[model samples]
Target: MKRVINFWSLLGFISVSAFLATEIAVVAAAVVWGISSLFGLAMVPTIALGILVGVPSLYGMVKATILAFQAETDPENN
Candidate 1:
């Protein structure tokens, strides 16, 4: 039998994943900024570093979440 993935399930999964990614990025940015401030690091470099770290993780999470819902080509292969 072929595996099936419904639209709503995929949508809900992606939406929740995006929300989680956003929350993580925001928290990471705040923590990095705070730590940089404590150490007297410059604002521009701190923000840049935060974006460098957060954006890739966010992209990776979203990609992984979407891939998780993909239907298998051969259900029995699993």
Candidate 2:
């Protein structure tokens, strides 16, 4: 049978993804900034580095969140 994803479920998944992605990006940015700061790097470079790190982290977090949601909502396993 073809699986049909409900609208509400998709919306909830998106909301959850946003929350997780935000947290992941924040943590990643903090870590990158902290490391750069420890090395006595300039504030501007540190902030730039944090942004670079945060973007990839957000992508990874979103992908992971999608996988988790898919696992939970897998109709076959129900």
Candidate 3:
């Protein structure tokens, strides 16, 4: 049988998923920054370190979205 995916549902799912991904990433970055600060790292370096974590998380989110888009949607689920 030919599988089908809903364009509108996929769009909405990715939009929400991306937003949540970034939201979690930001929190993770903040925790990293806080921990570094507590360990005596200077302000500027901590922020930079946070970006290191954040950028990869954003990359992961993009990859996940692409992969999810490729998934086969079950007709029964529709």
Candidate 4:
């Protein structure tokens, strides 16, 4: 027996996964900013902190998701 991965399927899966992750991050950042506002944190510092934390976290998550998807789709896995 043999297995095959469809290129388009992988691409679409990765793209959609990344997109959903970005959307979640955006919402989370907004919530963090809003909470900081309630605590009277300076807007500039809050925005900077959000960018510093959010970017790398999002990147890591997306990278991990892609790797996992690839592993699952690998024909040799079977």
Candidate 3 vs. truth: CA RMSD? 3.2
Local accuracy of candidate 2 as per-residue lDDT tens digits, 13-53: 67777787778877897889678978988879888887788
1 versus 4: better lDDT goes to: 4
Q: What is candidate 4's TM-score against the reference?
A: 0.54
Report the Cα RMSD per candidate: 4.3, 2.8, 3.2, 3.8
Which candidate should be chosen as best, given TM-score against the real structure? 2
Tens-place lDDT digits, model 3, residues 1-78: 544667875776677677767776778777886789689888787888788877887787777666555552445445
- Candidates' C-alpha lDDT: 0.67, 0.76, 0.71, 0.72
Per-residue accuracy of model 4 over 52-74 as CA lDDT, tens digit each: 77787778677867765766576
Which order, best to worst by TM-score?
2, 3, 1, 4
For model 4 the local lDDT of residue 63 reads 80
Each model's total of backbone clashes: 0, 0, 0, 0
Lowest summed lDDT window (length 10), candidate 2 = 1-10
Better of 1 and 3 by lDDT: 3
Which number leads on lDDT?
2
